[model samples]
Target: MLHGAGGSGEQVLPYFTALGDRLSMAVVAPTAQQPVQTTSNLDLAGIFGSRFRMPRWDLAGRDFPLAALRWALTELGADPNRCVLAGVSMGGLATWNLSMRFWHSFAAAVPLNGALSIWESFGTDARTRALLPNTLPLPLFVVHGGKDERISPEFDRESVRTLRDLGHQEVEYVEVPEGAHGLDTLGLAEGSPLFRQLERRLCRASRTDQSASISHRANEDTHGRAHWVGLDGITPQRTAEVHARWTAADRVDIEASGARRVALYLRGDRLSPGDMVTVTVNGVVSPVRFTPDLATVHHTFQNTVDPGLVAEQVIRLDVPQPPGDEPAEPTNRTRGRDAETI
Candidate 1:
């Protein structure tokens, strides 16, 4: 779980101690890496605050915050598939940001009184719009106060509506009519909507790899892979996307945009353990040998630190272009190495 602005992991322990005990779960919260020196809330500007001196998640980058959370999980040996991320205020925004970017890392997310709409432009929309269909399953429980003055409740309401309109079915938005910006108070209640959502979603393993179809988008290599699929050789400063579907017992259809390489991390799911599998990239068709490498399993587990997500085999395929197609323009940015198993 992440803490709000100007807040520490220790400061939010009391909020979840009783709930964690009741649920038989351990709560691990990590402090943000950067601290903003500030005297009053007024000193901060916009949603992040001005000249912020309080410790908070860095919205501009993903390395520090992600590394911190994963390090804590690694130390505790926490089950990534069963973990749920919940946060309040600025932390609430961090929850949304991290969960969306790394959907396979957590089962569900609860963001209380977060500035959902404001962060939409900053991180959510650009990073997720292309993969919304794939991301819709990562359940969300959102709460906001109708009387919130610091972060308007109407913002969350509008964002929720937009998500629903975009076909996200598992999102739940709750508004406390009489509450204010400090809706973290409600999150402490056992009967609150956020807690109930966690009760229903937490502790359940997220079977992201079992899906028949998968879609993913990424602007950077570090955030490229999702579920059992990955996009590689993406152009710098360009977002790459890939969609794959099991069309038949032994056939997989794949389409990619803004990418030159794609990989299928396979398990025993319809196509694995077989001698040969048919792969269709764009419209080109080919037969590829299916081989499960033990080394791959070890390497994947080492990277993800989750046995449930390890793939039995990986099939690397180059994105095919139509005949007579012109090559893309070259850029100064160098491409990263091949994608690792998700």
Candidate 2:
């Protein structure tokens, strides 16, 4: 479990109580790294008043909360394959970002009254808009308020549309007619439909074996270029694929089998004049055309290798830096901002 901006683990403890005793599961509510003295009802009209903002979960780039979650699961001896991630407000935004990058890590996800992307909240760029269709086909239970003015409900609706368009079949979206940003006000009570859906997903995961799964790891270089690594499952029959949202100077490495048709999805809207992508499969290099939008690059090798043999394929994108003298600084929009109230 995670808390919203300006909220602590103690603040969200009541949400755990609402689950009741029907679900017997170990829960871990990790507190944020930074704390705020302001409560949920703090006034935000004055700019220089007694205002505070807690540290965000770092969903966009660093993903510090994900590392903490892994440590928590290890310490508690909990089965991460059967885990469920639920959050509210800014925590809800982290839910979407984390789950999308680590699709196979959780059985299901529940995000309440949250914006799907940074584009929905502050503004839009090519990178943010490109992340829309990459929502994985995980069983998602979304709850929002029709009267929420802080974060528009249209973000949830558009997210649902993008998920459905990307072939997500098991999606449940519920809208409270008169609810606000609070979980209780959103109708996630003891016998609510959201709980029922979560229970069903938990039951289904209990009967399946998900020991072999694919996971993604992301890192950024000192120059702000992103790097992604996708590890396929151990089983031979599973299809190997990599999905990534990249800037111009990003690099990706995928471990795949020769028998599998590797599908690579690359999203970049700021392709330079001489930008080119080099795909190296088992040391055979080939240059591919770089489009100004999303591109699906597919490669199938005729030399069939053993299904168990995994080979590392490299994709190096050579993009010249933009001709500007100003250095870019990373910014966190969710931090130091006033949070929506109940």
Candidate 3:
């Protein structure tokens, strides 16, 4: 499974807990081999990654990521023939590219509200056609938001139409109800009919695969928030880290934005010095900082969750435990940030 733009497997996992259970599949959310800078949330464009950006999926990514995926599959002892490839945003684009490049690898491919190019179509000459015909049909699970104006849901329709025009036999298209560009954790929990359809597709291949439980399920909270299927309940986890002395001065606001990668920002969390400082947020930790003048720093962390689950939203920042004085209560703040549902 891959995440959207600005997301590593880590950041996007929480938004897909239900998908995990529905598929009854073990998941691999390896971090991107290297960070890619992107600005657009759609088409998985990175705002500040040095490693990748949109329009670079053509044999243009680092080798390590694919190598790592191979290693991971081997470690899982998974049968590559039965593997399903699914991703959102840039990851979706990656999956599309992989399907074309490694045509024989995946059993099924799912690209959620993403753009894909086979590259083979670009060339008009005979050699190019011989090298890459319109290509083979891929069983697809195409999902998108009917109202996602950012990239426009119509693009998804066009993709499906293209596949049908190419004589593809199997194509499953799902349009989320009242959906938008960044359908994050809340949107998932708000409940979508898409879940049942997704589950059907996930398990469609293997009535025999029932013995394998790729993931677990979580009980719904009072408000209907769902966690991971196999990794149920909130795991009260804690760790320690230092913070910018400057963060003490800036009021940080966390925004879920209804998409993966919880975003944290402070008007001026930057310290007087231009140094990288360590800080923790929402019991999750990160290490990046800015100078006093560069007060605005957005730290986005990803997690996968069952989109339909509901729970209290809180963020805990680990402030340094000052030696002489009593340690401050773990700073607690609440925000509405969410992991993307795509």
Q: Give the number of the best model, judged by TM-score.
A: 1
Tens digit of per-residue lDDT, candidate 2, span 1-342: 777777876788677664535666665666666433343322211232244454666554244456555665556655655677777877777777666555545667778887655443434323333444434447787888998876678888888877788677777778889988776687656777766766666556521232122333222121011122333221121222333332225333333331222333333333453457655443344565545322212221111111111122323432222345222322422322223111
- Show where candidate 1 strays beyond 4 Å: 35-54, 58-61, 68-77, 116-134, 191-209, 268-274, 321-342
The sequence of per-residue lDDT tens digits that candidate 3 reaches over residues 11-36 is 77777776766665766765554334
- Return the TM-score for candidate 1, rounded to 2 decimals: 0.80
Off by over 4 Å in 3: 35-65, 117-135, 185-192, 206-342
lDDT of each: 0.66, 0.50, 0.42
Between prediction 2 and prediction 3, which has the larger TM-score?
2
For candidate 2, the 10 contiguous residues with the lowest summed lDDT are 300-309
Report residue 222 deviation for candidate 1 (angstroms).
1.7
Instruction: Give the candidates in order of lDDT, highest first.
Output: 1, 2, 3
List of clashing residue pairs for candidate 2: none
Q: Highest lDDT among the candidates is held by which one? A: 1
TM-score of each: 0.80, 0.58, 0.47
